[model samples]
Target chain A: MKPITKLTENEKKSALRIFWGQLRKVNRNVPEQDKIKFLKRIPFFELLKKHQLDEVARVVYEREYRDGEYIFEIDQPGAALFIIQSGEISVEIPTPKGEATQLAVISKNAFFGELALLDESPRSASARAIVPTKVLALFRKDLDKLNSTNPDITANIYKSLATIIGNRLKATNELIERKIKAVA
Target chain B: MSGSERSRKTRRIVVYSMTSIFFSILIAGIVYGLQPMILPFIIGAFLAYLFKPLANSFRGPAITKYIRAGALLFFVGSITYWGTTFIKASLPNEREKLQLKVRLQYRLNERYLSLMNLADGGKGNFIYKTLGQEFDELKKRVIDYVKMSDDERKRFLILQKEISDSDHENKKYYEYYLANLKNQKVDIEKLKSLAGSAIVAIEKPAGDDIGNLANIMRALSHWIILPLAFIFILLDKGQIFHFFLRLIPNRYFELAYTVAEKVDDALGKYIRGTMLECLLVGLTLFIGLFISGVELKMAIIIGMVGGLTNAIPFVGTFIACIMGVFYSLIAENVHSFLPFINENNLMIAVLAVVVIAHLLDNAIYQPLVVGSAVNIHPLVVILSVFGGSLMFGFAGMIFAIPTIVIIKVVTETLFAGLKDYRII
Candidate 1:
């Protein structure tokens, strides 16, 4: 019969060695640089460092939508922020006349559904793919998870999101001023 | 519709249906063939899921994957090492007790045989009666053979020697056998045969080896296979998930992915939370018992059991309480180590400790660890625990709540999706 005491010790040593070896290989294989590059292009993720971006990439999901497919419907619960990787997405709002009015055409490298990163609320407008589109989705649950572990990355993401929203609000204000000036 | 469009839709449906049927059969066959490995796979998957967050946390610039993996390996390895050492230390005492019990059982069987011989009026029982004159003739021939050689007689005497000669108290049965032999009607050969059969009956069962084999299997899986599988799963998590996603038809891929995400969210939180809760409860109870002056070893074992049983919802607390009381009483009666403490005092102390531990668990640990992850009603919790215990015993009871939560989340997501499509 084999000596169990000796066998157990040997197994423990071997398992640790194997695990360390595998972990090093896996770490080397992680595509951190690629993810960092992708995150750098988005305004919300631009403030994040390379390592911070890696943390964000861990929880983000990539999805492909066919042409003419609805990304989300109006008044649906907004739970995730979507960043456009390629192709075009059209945002539409229902007007008082009960007809769809185009809000904005979001193209490659832009993002939509920014409000979801802050709160759990319904979408104000619907977003649909104008062409076959690829987007990265960052959900609130994943964000909250990241918040617990890497608070710096999460805080930076929120800060960038706020800046983006502020910029959009200012642009909208400028457009309204222009419209009012024209009417006057 | 146009003719071309109608034909294309029909062809698409046929292809999808056929592919689904073929894949379903293939998956079923694979599952059936891999039945034995299913438990290890599940265990590995669970560990991978549980540690994923920790693994992800290591993605920061300061830490390398080697360091992260090493930390996890060290943590799990230490726990396993400690647990094995504890079991090893306790095993000798447990084995000794088992041997004592077996010896007592053997003695009881010997007494039973002696009683049967007494009931037969010392005529060597039914076997002697069946043999009749042949038995008498054989006994005489054996006596004659023994008388012919001194060495043969000595050997024959040694053969008839009492097996329990070391124990003075149990020598009465042997004396009774000697008295029966003195009676001419009793055949020596038949008595020897009966004694041999009794010895055979008292021999340890061969089933012990099978039990040991099972223990070895469990140990190997828990310590080796599980961790190895977990590492692989964590390393290839995205690939594995994508592989499953690729299996879905393009039309339903998005919906299926959403459903899977919801299920994963619910089940992951519930499972990880419950594990934390169990650990907290167990540690709290252990500390409480230790403070209350209970024996360290017994307290540790009972506390661990109580904590693990906490996974069974409402019933778990009750079981833990019962175990605490029973173990406390046993310690009180046997060890009597607590000076000037009577049974009532010990019982009261145990009850108070258990109650305080339960309160702490409910008020602090439960809210923090489990939160409102599983929002099932208390009534539903009770029914599920009972149903699970009835169906799958302990494992069922432990898993029932999480299983129900997954079902609830998936069905809600599906219904929501249907509502969005206006199909429900």
Candidate 2:
């Protein structure tokens, strides 16, 4: 084992090569390509680069939900953003008459609970799996951890999350305006 | 349910129980057989756990996985090396200081005993009377031995050296006994028997050769095996977790994963935060004591012991305070830092410092560093510490809270799952 300070350029390069080779061998389970593909599907991750997406993949937890299972309840303390990998999720809010009104039927590649990642707030609406669903959850804790270690990647993730939330707010305002116009 | 389904379920249950029992025994056997190797692996796992968040942070576009792991390993290894070197350099000095303090304590005790004998009208001073004569005879023998010819002196010295070398503590006591000898009645046999028993009690068992061998093994494991395990475990944690998940049946994978995540959430934050809190507290105490002119090495040792005990929740602070006071008293009596600073004043200062440290920890550090990691009540923490101590001693007390939190999370999850399945 050569001391790092004493190593020549060639030796350093060979050491790095071997180190990377071992790492790649150990991490053969989660392919970078698969992680990239998964991240590419979610609009909230659109601004992240391939490498940044790989960082996100390292912290993202993949969860599977059976059909008719509630992904999260309305008014539950939100702690993560969920991206659907497969199957549909119904995003619904409770109406004044004590009934659930369907807001949207979110499908694969889409995401929900994006607001949770940006702030420590309760979920505004409930999300339930309409089918057997596989979702990738990127927790706020993991993001905060990432922020300390890799600020660049965390900044990109926050930017992407903000954009997605901004778009959703704009769409909601438009829907309200149209509803008012129709009522008048 | 169908008849075939019922039979299959029963068989599955039986097999599962048998498998669990077999594996438990197998694991126990392996642990017992490889006890010497296990400490390193446990320490490595703990190190890997502690560094996981930091390691994860470095896994971004700029740094490759290998570089991140290597950097972490290098950092941890350097710290460990520096710490061990520091301890090695300071240990002998600390030991000498402690021995000096012990000798002073013995001298003080002997003086107090002599004073009591004089106050009691020396004739009825039974303690002095009984032990004094034996010590006088012992002193006379020593004087005679010293005055003897070369061959006689050599024979006497050989016999005396064997007894004296048996235990350092008893040798100190013997010195006190000889020094305090006076013209008073005594029982030589009884005094000799008492001193002999004390020597026997203090003597290290001959079996310590095996113990020393184990210690050497542990040291090798700590220095070499632990860091390597930590690096490798940090590198492939996700892969390892996935491999374990794959081993679970598909039907149970989600449940197991959820349970594992809950356990991590319950234990990980608490453990990490508590460790950081302890380090901060320990470092603060060390600095405070050093500033107060406490002996540097003794200050470090006391601060460290206090900080490590801080893991046991409520009572740990009190224990640390007691230790602080005890050491401060000893320091004041032995080597007065200043003429104005008497024993009482030093005690008050020590207590005040410890109290202030505790206040700062509770008000500022605990909220920020530890922060609702474990939601157990204060009362529960106290009870659990006692209960754990009673059941499993010191280690239990340290781990009891986290263990309870894990259990709570598991039970709540199980109840929620049961309700979801409409089985309750």
Give the per-residue lDDT of model 1 (tens digit) for B86-144.
86775535323423333333333333345336334464567656764685575456444
Model 2: which docking level applies?
A: incorrect
Clashing residue pairs in candidate 2 are B129-B185
TM-score of chain B of each: 0.65, 0.63
CAPRI quality band, candidate 1: incorrect
What tens digits encode model 2's per-residue C-alpha lDDT throughout A1-184?
9665688899989998788668655654555558667787776777786656776787776778877777776776566788898999999998899988998999989888887777757789989899999888777766876797768888878887777778879999999999999999
lDDT of 2: 0.69
List ranges where model 1 is wrong by over 4 Å.
Answer: A1-59, A95-99, B1-11, B54-62, B77-81, B84-225, B236-265, B291-293, B324-340, B389-395, B413-424
DockQ of each: 0.12, 0.17
Q: Worst lDDT window (10 residues) for model 2 chain B? A: B148-157
Considering summed lDDT, which 10 consecutive residues are worst modelled in model 1 chain B? B146-155
Q: How does residue B286 of candidate 2 score in lDDT? A: 80
When candidate 2 is compared with the true two-chain complex, its DockQ is 0.17
